[model samples]
Target: MALEAGTVVVDAAVTQAEPSSPQARTERFAWGPVLCLWVLLTGWSLLRVPIPGVNEPHYLGKARHWWNPDWCPGDFFLDSSNPHLVYYATFGSLTQWLAFDQAAFAGRAIGLLIVALGWQRLSQSLTGRRWDGVLALPVFLTLHATGNFSGEWLVGGTESKVPAYGFLFWAIGNLLIGRLLPAGALAGLAVSFHPLVGLWGVIAGAIATAGVLLQRRRRHDLQPTETTYSLVNIAAAVGLGVLLALPGLIPALQTLEGGDPQLEHAATQLQVAERLSHHLDPMRFPKTAYWFAGSLLAIWLLLLRDFPNDSRQRWWRWFVLSAVFIAVVGIAIGFGPRPMAQMPGFGWRSSLLKFYPFRLGDLILPVAVSLAAVQAVMSWTQQPSASVSKKSLLTAGLVACVIGAISIPFPDQNPSRLSPREQEDWIAACHWLRDHTERTAQVYATDVGWAIKWFAERPEYVNYKDVPQDAKSLVEWNQRLWKIARWRIAVMADGQVTPEELADLKQQTGLYALLVGRFGPVKAKPAYANENYRVYVLP
Candidate 1:
């Protein structure tokens, strides 16, 4: 069950290449790689104007008034203490102190920097190769350039996962090295930032750690008499984890009452993504899911079956364990809950969670393939074995690259609500509202309302958080905002806002102005019309 002599030789070389002493580690700390990745991912965020559609306003609006978070006017995200409270406090304080429209851009740059550093450190730890970090830069960026745009890359600006994953990768590296206390603390902060992704990280991490212990046990190596830090280590790890997680956990538990029912009710009310039909119908196999999951599983099993059972290349086993756990959770989420999405006016049904499992699988596939390819190639270089050859290594690399290339669901453009020009138009419209509207005026805007709330410093008729808000009034407002805004934008009909509907909305919602796009209804009388947009004050 020992590592093949050839693999052992590769490990020896890696050990010689990596630094062991504290001062040496500092010397080897990677800056060039981080700098390269930061520049690549944030070019649009930094050098060019900030791209608007990635929900920048949603988070920035919360930061707009740090001391007070206005969740679409009167409502609030925190009835008491909330996880986002601290996040807003920190980000809001910075945005106010610096005072710029590109706060989200700066925040994203900071997030990418953290990710770059964390990725460098974690990649080296996971693969036991210092150079792998340098290579991973192009690998990760290339995936985005050629990634499933809707699934992997965010729709809007840097969402919570950007920072959350930074901490998550670092935490997992620590967990694998048996440094439980730091791992616990890092994992806690990760959760505080974004519960959904962080929760998955925690679950996957625990399973990876347990998988190691299980492997040891199967080899008859878990005896109490053996020299090992077992129960004591586990206790300390759990204690630190709970202590560090208190900030996120306490507020979450406090707010957990009736949370599920609210979520269920919200799911029923919200519009399901049209693509979700592929997952709901048994006849329509989950092609996206199968493509990624299949690639990941195939490579993982290859390592397990081919590599020596006790090979020092532990990432393979860890990834397999984590992938299995993620798959199970994804399956449960996809199939367990009631349908969260549906085809409007159609009989088909799909859960919001339905495609998530596949999404997770897709995310993991690249990392798995990349890791396996690099390590296998390295193994072949060192091993004088009959089991592997140069041909096998090239084949693996080609396969991984192909999978990554194909997984890119959208290659032509990124996933955003507006193009760069349209984003400028929206920004111009927001500036107009700021200059003209009363401070307390609640305008009627669509998904662009979040931007209005921030830039215009005025309330809008609705928001897009049906998943969180349960109040009958807010829920209705949320639904109406989409229906009204989309209707005005000609979502359903031939780009026309019927006169009767517009009048009824103005009377009911007290909407003072209609912020119309260039393609909006012909009847809109422009109080202010720019090249990109037109705003009509309701008569």
Candidate 2:
């Protein structure tokens, strides 16, 4: 019999004879042990990586700027469109009290905690065992670290997508149990943080749900006992999701609209060809990535030799298949016979490619591998026991070794994409700029990377690493980068520029100062000099 609207559909693995209430659901899983394991593992993961990770400054700087516009006033990329407004409003508000580095550490800890808890809940729900999540945690972390076909990762750094993935995991867990409304609400929250991460999850989940319904229908004569959500429930979930996601959805949609065709095309091509080719272009993937992905798949298949017959197996199978199908479609589109522009339906495919279709599979497949391995091991070992077996001791030893190796706190931890000496010199130069220069000062630096605005609190003239998202701004940002490149090649040599060149750059770009790596053959004496860098005051 089909349940009425607003009913919480229980999983087939869960006994249907039990009274279904919110309190019963809350008490379904033991939280104490899961939380303890989550904290230890997640804390270790966060501390393993240093702060200001590759994209940390990229995101946290913008976040700081969002709350306090005066932080990096007039910076081009900082002033660009705000697609992750919800993230800025929530996590970015940390700038009010904490320093940028401190905020990054705090944010990473919280986000990873959410991710860890979500993964545990999902694992436990899918396996119908309390300790499966703990068993799978180390494997999941290791696989996620090494097994990505695209440049996608779950842990590391503070960004909008961290929390988005957390909520996405929760949504997927709820979906496994047919709790559509809660799943939809969680998915919507994920979208509010980062649209693409959550939207791809929703698509994969919808496909899985469809497969479940079709299979159930085909086997109607057998009268399957598993619970499935009705169409009305799906509609309500989608409706609630849309309603909750408007804050982020509206702004993201706006970026794609109201752009000149030529400018938009230029922006799309730049993103696909130059800026994000490593992510969007499948042909460019490294050979090692393929090996890693293939190895994980082989291991999963080997472990799951005979798939367990359980009520939840169908959902797990369908979800994995959906994720793989999405990845294959992405590969097919990206691996065009010719250039994307030369292909049929060029605009449609290029635009779709930008959303990164391979990401879902890159992330999801690792989770599946972890869960499947845990299920297999648990089944072979029988029920949970207080006595630790020899195999259990071995597994624990392996987990400890892996965690210790990755979490080695090296002395020379330079997190700002700079070498130890360069980071120190860069910070000193930025300190000079922050103290000596005005807030309106626009400094130009080619090799400083992304943290000048973060450390110096001054606007940047142009930075190649920081690209604006809006169509017009993207084109302009590109032009500025090329102009800087041309000037550097023509005039600057051996990390040196003459006074005449400095004056010309000042006149051309209205830059207040020039910061360059320390080198000889400079015609003009610098206003400030460090062991690794020099700051030249412009005319």
Q: Which candidate comes out best when scored by lDDT?
A: 2
Give one digit per residue, the lDDT tens place, for model 1 in 361-463: 4455565555555555556666666355565755566556445543444422332356778767777887888798776566765444435665666666665
Q: Which candidate number maximizes TM-score?
A: 2
Worst 10 residues of 1 by lDDT: 1-10
Write one digit per residue (lDDT tens) for candidate 2, span 1-539. Answer: 11111123233322232344221243265677468655756565556566667777778888888888887688888888888888888888887889888888888877877776677667766766666777776777676554479888777777888889888887766665667677677788888888888888777766765676577678754244655555676678777777777777777877777657888888988887678888988877888987887787677668767765444566667767787788889888877645556767667777878988988888888888888877776666664653468568648754774675465453213456577787888889989998999998998876665478778878887777777777888888898888778877778555666788878878888889888874334688888888888888987
Candidate 1, superposed: residue stretches over 4 Å from native: 1-50, 66-83, 99-101, 148-150, 153-156, 220-233, 253-255, 259-286, 303-312, 332-361, 380-422, 446-450, 454-457, 463-474, 482-503, 518-524
Candidate 2 lDDT trough over 10 residues, lowest sum: 1-10
Task: Write down the lDDT of every candidate, Cα atoms only.
Answer: 0.53, 0.73
What's the distance in Å from true for residue 50, model 2? 0.7
